[model samples]
Target: MSDQTTNQQQSAAAMNEPLLSVRDLRVAFGTKKEPNEVIHGINFDVFPGETVAIVGESGSGKSTTMHAVINLLPGTGRVTDGSVQWNGRELVGIGRRDMETIRGREIGLVPQDPMSNLNPVWSVGFQVEEAIRANGLAKTKKEAKARAIEVLEQAGLQDAERRMRQYPHQFSGGMKQRALIGIGLSASPQLLIADEPTSALDVTVQRVVLDHLAKLTSELGTAVVFITHDLGLAAERAEKLIVMYKGNIVESGPSKEILQRPQHPYTKRLVAAAPSLASRRIGAEATMPAAPTSTFDVAALAEAEGHGSKPGEPVIEVENLRKVYKLRKGNFGSEDFVAVDGATFTIRKGETLALVGESGSGKSTIAKMVLQLEEPSGGSVRIAGKETAGMSSSELFELRSKLQPVFQDPYGSLDPLRNIGNTIMEPLNIHNVGDRESRKQRVLELLDQVSLPRELATRYPNELSGGQRQRVAVARGLALKPEILVLDEAVSALDVLVQAQILDLLAELQRDLGLTYLFITHDLAVVRLIADRVCVMQQGKIVEQATTEEVFENPQQEYTKNLLAAIPGASIELGIVEAGDHVPHTPVAGSGSAPFAGGGQAGAQA
Candidate 1:
C-alpha cells in the first residue's frame, strides 16, 4: 500500500542518521583564574528509538553534562572540547539563530519541578501554545491552540478545553506534570530529555508517567535521554545505562547487565541499598542463635544487647483529638482557619502507625502536638499512660527519653556545625546518660546499629548523602531508645531506591527492636510497604482508619478515594488492590518526533 511505503520511507530516513552523537565531550566552569572541569572527556552515541539513562548521585556531573548538551549551561560554563552531531549535521558550533530554530522543535526538555515550569501569569494552554508556535508547527494562532489542546489531552489531562484556561496554581502536582509533558511534546521533538521527571511525585503518578513515556518512545521510535539518581528506576526503564560519578562515566552498559550485576563498586552499593522485601527475604539472617532462655521476648534480648524490641503497654494514646488555628486578617482580625478538626489517632507500643495525607492535611500538626513541639488547643496526649495536657515543661522533660522525633529534612533538623557523633550524643548528654567517653562510644555503637560505618562519626552532616544523614537522624532518635518514634516525611526527600532502603531499615529495626512508629507521609507506596495500620486524613481530620490491607483495598471515604483516583495508573491492577477493583482500558500512545539538528546542542552520549 502507498501508506506502508510512506511509513517505510520515514523509518529509513530516521534510521539512516544518528539523532544525537557526542564524542570526547568535556565541560568546565569558573573564571580562567580558577576553572573547574566538571565533565571529563566522555563519548557516547544516541541513535533513534532508544532511552539512554545517565544516573548518579548528587555532584555526579550528570546534570552538568545534560545542561551542556541542551546548551542551557550557566555563565562561565562551556564545552571545552567535544564534537556534537545531530541528524548528520554538526551542532556544537551552530549560530544562535539556528539554535533557536532547533530548541523547541528538535529538543524537548522536561525539567524537575513542574510547578516552576509554567508562567504564573499565563494559563496552561498559553504555555503549550507558545512552545508550539516556537517550534513553527502551526501556521496560525488558532492552529496553535488546537495543537496545544490535542497534546494536553494526549498527556492525560482530562477536559483539556476547560483546563487550558486555568492558571498553573490551580492544578495539582501530577496535573502540573502532565501540563509540562504536554508542552514538551507539543514541539514533536525527535529527542526528549527528562531530568528527574518523577521526583517528588507519588508512586502512582510516577508509574503513569513512566508508562506513557515508554509507550510514546516505543511507538514513535523517539530517542530519549533520561536523567535520574534512582537506580531502581534506571533498571526498570532504561535500555542503556550510563553510570556517572564526580564528572566521569564510571560504567556504561545495558541496563539489565549493569543493574543485575554492576561492575563498579558504587553501582553495586547503589543497587544493594534499595529498600526491597525481596532483598530482605533473601538476606534475613538465620535467627540470631537463640539467646539464653529469658523472661522477655527475643525483642527484649536484642534490646538488652543494644538491639532489643519488646512490645510493652501502649506508649502513646490519643482519642478524638482536635486542634484549630484561626486565621486573622481584617483590621479587627475576624478570620477563622480550621486547620485540624477532631483528628483522632493512637500509636501502640512496638508498632508503626502511618498517618498519611497530602499537604495541609494536619499530619505534621498531629506530630507536633504529640512531640510537644506545638501546643494543642484541644487534645489529650497520653505518654506512658498519663495525659500530657497539664504537664509542665519539667514534667515533659522528665519523659523526653520515652518519646523522640526524626524530622523530614535531616540537615534542617540537625545542627550543621556538630559532627554526627556529637549530634547523636546530644540527647545522651542532655539526659546526663554518661561521661564524654561513654557517650562517644555510645554514638559509635548507635551508628553501627543504623548500618553506618563507625568512621563516619567524625564527619559533618554536609558530607553525608540524604539517606546517610537520615540514618544518622534515626540513630539520634534511638540514642535513648524511645518507646515511640515519630517520623514526619523523614525519608520522602530520598530517591525511590534510597527511600526503599531506609524503609527496609526501619522495618527491620521495628521487627528486631519492636520500635513503635507514628509514620507520617503522603507517599502511598511507602505506606503500603511499611504500615500495619493506616489512617487517611483530609482537611485536618481522620476520614478513614483500617489495616493497611483494608485501607489500600477498600478505601471507604470519598476523599481517600479521590486521592487514590488522582494516582496515575490506578486503573491497572498492580496487586495493590483487590481483584474486584481492577478496570481494564486500552492505553493511549504518542508518536516521537526528533529534535532539530542545528540547535547547537551537544549530541547525547549513548
Candidate 2:
C-alpha cells in the first residue's frame, strides 16, 4: 500500500472506533481484604494503527495498568474496579482460557528486562517458534521455524538463523532484547504493548527497531502502547502522550503539545529534565560559535568550565589497550574475537570523558580492563603515573579502593539480601576503613551525598524504586572514596527526571571532590549533557575523539554523524527554552587528550 493510503486508512480507523478502551481502570496487589492499589482509575484508548505512549518514572503504575488489562499482573495484582474493552468485548473478569486465546493473537506484550522475560533454558529460536505456534500463526513445525527466523530478522537481529540456535545467555544484552522483540512481534497482533523495548539497545539499533515497529503499524494496522521513561522518544514516536505519576494520569494530549507545553507540574519537570531539551538549553545559555544547524554547542559548555585550557594531572592513562576472547568451536578449534583494539584514552582529575558507541563496540570491554575486572591481552594502564600491568593480587585489591565501577543495572550490581547501609559499608569493612560506629556514620554521610534519605539505610534493594536503587549504588561506589569512577551505561535505563538528578549529583560530587569519571554510554544526548570530551567507538576502535561540541557540531566521521542523527526527538522543535534560564557556568577542573587513531584529529583535548 502507498504511504498516503496507509495514513488515510489509519485516520479512518481512528475515526471508526478504538481497538482497546480502558475506562477508570484500577489495579491493586496483596490480599483481597487489604489490597494496595497501584493503578487508580486511569482511562486511555488505543486506536488501530495509532501509537500512544505512557511516560512516567518507575513505579508510576504504568506497567501495572497495562498488565491489569491483559490479566498478566504479577503476584496478587488484580483489577479491583473499572473496565477494559477489546473490540467492544468486556475483559474485566474474563476467563483465563479466553484471555490466553486473545493474549498473543489480539494483544502482544514486549516486556521490560529481557533477561528475565526470556527463557534461559531454551534456544532463542525455540522461544520464537513457540510463540508463533502458540498464537496459531503457523501450522507445521517447519513453517513455524521459518516464520521465527523472519521475525527475528525483522526485529533487527542479524544472522537470525545462527542466532536462533543460541541461548539467551550467549547473547549480549542488546541481542537478547532483540530476540524478545522478535517473539513479541511474531504473531503480528492487533495491539502491541512495548514496555521499554529499546532500553537495552543503542541509538542506531533503537532507530531501526522503532522504524520496523512503525512499518508494522502502518502495514498491518497494529496499535502500539509504548511504555517508556524517555520523554524524548515518547515525543518522537507516539501520537498521544499519557503522563502518569504515582497512580493517576496527570496529563494526556498530543505528544508534541505535551513536550512543548506540559500542563502538569510532573510533566513540566519531565520535559525540563529531558536530556535533549536540557542540552539545547545549555547550548543557548553558553557563549560559543553556533554550529551550521541549531545543534547544541556542548563543547562551549566544556570550554566555559575551563576544559582544555588548564590541564590537571592525569589520574588514569590507557595506551594500546586490547582485549581478545577465544571462542571455542566444536571443542577442538577456537576463533579469536578482538573486543578492544589498541584503544587509548587519558582521564584527568575532575573531568568526565564519555565513551560513546553502539553495543559490542568495546566500550564496556575497555571499562572492564581499566577496572582490572578483565585482563587485557595487550596494553598499558597507568594509575597515578604507576604502571598496573603486573600488579599483584594484593596490589590490585588496594588499587580497587581508588578505582570503583558503577554498572548499568543497579539491581544486578547490588546485593538484594543486604540492607542499603551494609551494602554501602561493605567496602569500608573490607578495607577496614573505620570502626563500627565510624563506618555507620560514614554510610549516613554517603547517603546524604547521593541525595538519598538516611532512613533508607535499613531498606533492601527490592523495596526501593529504580532511581533510589541507583542512588544506593552510587553511595556504595563512594564508600571507598574512589578517585575515579567507571560508569557503564549508568543512566541509560533511568527515567529523564531521575537521570538528570543523577547527573547533577555526579557533577556536584565532581566539583566538591576532585574525582574523575569514565562515562561509557550509548546515549549521545546524555553524552552532550555530561561529557567534557567524547570518544566515538566503532568495531572495537575509536573512530572520532574530540570535545563534545566539536563532535556534535562538526562530526568528521560518518559513523559519529549517524550516531548523532539517530538520537530520538532531535528533529522535534522544542521552542520552550526560557530566555533567562541557563546552566550555571562553573569552572570544573580537568583536561586530557585521546589521540584519535582513525579518520579524525590526533591528540584531541577538551
Candidate 3:
C-alpha cells in the first residue's frame, strides 16, 4: 500500500468521537491580481478530553487553521473550502451571532501574544467579566466579579481580586498571559485552542502554566487544540501530535511514537533542531556535527578581528542586588513584593553566562538592577571593577558605553515611528559618539555586521519581519561598541531556522568582539547552545551553578532535574512500546471524527 494511503487510514483511526472535526479545510487571500492560497486541503480532529498539538513552523497554517475553526479569520482571508464541525454542528454555515455564541462559551481561544490579545484601556477584570456577562452566565455585577476572581485563581494568578481592577499595562508579560488564559477559559468552554501558549516563557514558568492547563483540562474533560512550533513542548504536553508542513499533515501519531520514530522528514528536522535533543552530549560519533548555537555571538568575532584584547578586570559584578516593589492596594490588601532578593552574579570578559529559571524567578529583576533601570533597595553593582550602585546620573550615562541591553520583544524595543537606520543610530547619538556622517557610517557598518541589508534603513518596524526586527535590535546593541551585552530572551520569539541563523551570527560577533554576555532565557535548548556556564535560579536565588556541560549532563538540584525532566522526548529512548491497558490506543471505527481504516488500531507504534 502507498504511504499516503496508509497515513490517511491512520488519521481516520485516531478520531473516534472527536469534539471538533475539520475536513478538507482551505483558506486563501488577495485578489485575482495577486491571489495567494494559504491553506490547501487539510483535515484533523480534536477528541473529547484529549490535548492534540498542531506542530509546525511559522507560516505553516497552524494559526490559520485555528482562526478558521473559530470563524475568526481576518477580513483579508476567506475559507475557500472544507467544513469545520463542532459537536456534530456545521460551523461554516453558522451566522455571525450564532458563531459568537459558540466562540467563547463552547470553544475558547488564547492568542499567540497576550499584549495584542488584551484591551489596554479596560481593567482586566472588566474585560474578563464581559465574557460572563455577554454569555448570560452572570446577571449581576457581583456575580461577574466573583466569577472573574474564581477564573483568575484557576489560572494561577495571585491577587486575583485586585488584579481585575488593573489595566493590562500594569501586568507583566507572564502575568498578562495568565490573566488572558483566565478570560479564555472562564466560560467553561468544552474545547480550548491555545496558540504558542508559552513561547517565550522560562522553563519553570512554562511548567507551571502547562501544569495548570493539564489540570484544568483533566478536571473539566475539556478538549484542547494546542498549537506550537516547539517539538519538545509537543512531546511532553500533547497526548496526540499532528505534524504540519506547508499546510499538510505529513505525520500524525501518539506523542511518544512520533518523537521516537518520526516517519516524516519535517518531523526529523524538528527533532534535530531542538536544543534539548542536542543536549545529549555523550557517545557522539567522531564525525557528528557540533550542536547549534543561541543568539548572535558578537563578542567572539570582535576578538578574532583584533579589536583590542580583553580588559584586565571583570566587566560587571553584582554584590547582593535587591529590588523590592510595593504593590498598591486595590480591592484587596496592599503588600510589598520582592522581585530580586539579594541576587548576585558576575560576567567576565569574553564569556557567556546564562540565567536559567521559570517566570517570576527574578531574572528580569536582576537584569534591571544591573542595567540600573530599577533602583536596588540594597546591594552594589560594580561594572569594570568600578562601583555602579552610587554612580551619579552623569557617571551612569558614561557607563552606557560599557553596558548595553537587548530586550525580549524587538517590536516593543524599537520605535515604530523610526526606521531601522535611525533606530541603530540612536545609541550613537545618545552617547554623542560621533557627528551625523560618522553615525550614519556606523549604522551601515553595524547593519552589515548583523547581516542585515543596508536597504532596510528606510523601513519602519511594521515593515520588517520578526527576524529582521531582531537583527536591527542586535545592530542597535552593537552601535555603542559596548564591552558587555545583556541579552534578555533575545532569540526566544524566532523560529528554529531563524534562531539558528541568529545564534550563528551572535557566536561570530562574540568571537570577533571579545565582549562578555549575560544571557537570560528560560529555554534549556538555547542554554545548551551558547552558554559556557549555567545558573539555575528559583525564587530569586541561584539554586545551582555549573559549567554548561556539567549542568546539562549532570544536574544536581531537584528543581534543575525537574526542569530537565519536564523537557519533552527526554525520556524516550528510540523504541516503541506495545499497546496495553495502561498504554491505551483508540480502536478504529467507521464514521468517527477521525478517518477509520477498517479493523485497524488508531495509534502508530514506533
- List TM-score per model, in order: 0.60, 0.84, 0.78
Best by lDDT: 2
1-606 in candidate 2: lDDT tens per residue?
899999999778665898999999988877988888888899888888999999887667877888899999876789989999998999999999999999988899998777667888988889999999888889999999999999988888877886677677667677888888998998889999998888888989899899999998999989999989877788899999998888999899999998887666667667777777237322224443321121222232231222221348898899989988775455587668788999988888878999988877888888888898888999889987879888998888877877888886676787766777778878877876656666666677666665566766666676666667777787788666577889988877778766876777677566655678999988888888888889999988998999988999899999998988898888786535454444221121222211212221122111
As for lDDT, the candidate ahead, 1 or 2, is: 2
Off by over 4 Å in 3: 1-17, 121-123, 158-170, 216-219, 277-312, 330-334, 389-398, 418-481, 550-558, 573-606
Model 1: weakest 10-residue lDDT segment is 597-606
lDDT of all predictions, in order shown?
0.69, 0.79, 0.73
Q: What is the lDDT of candidate 2?
A: 0.79
- Better by TM-score, candidate 3 or 2: 2
Cα lDDT tens digits, model 1, 374-484, are 778876888767898889887888666667898755656777667777788788778776565556656666665555667666666755655567778888987876667
True lDDT of residue 139, candidate 2: 91
TM-score of model 2 vs. true structure = 0.84
Q: Give the TM-score ranking, best first.
A: 2, 3, 1
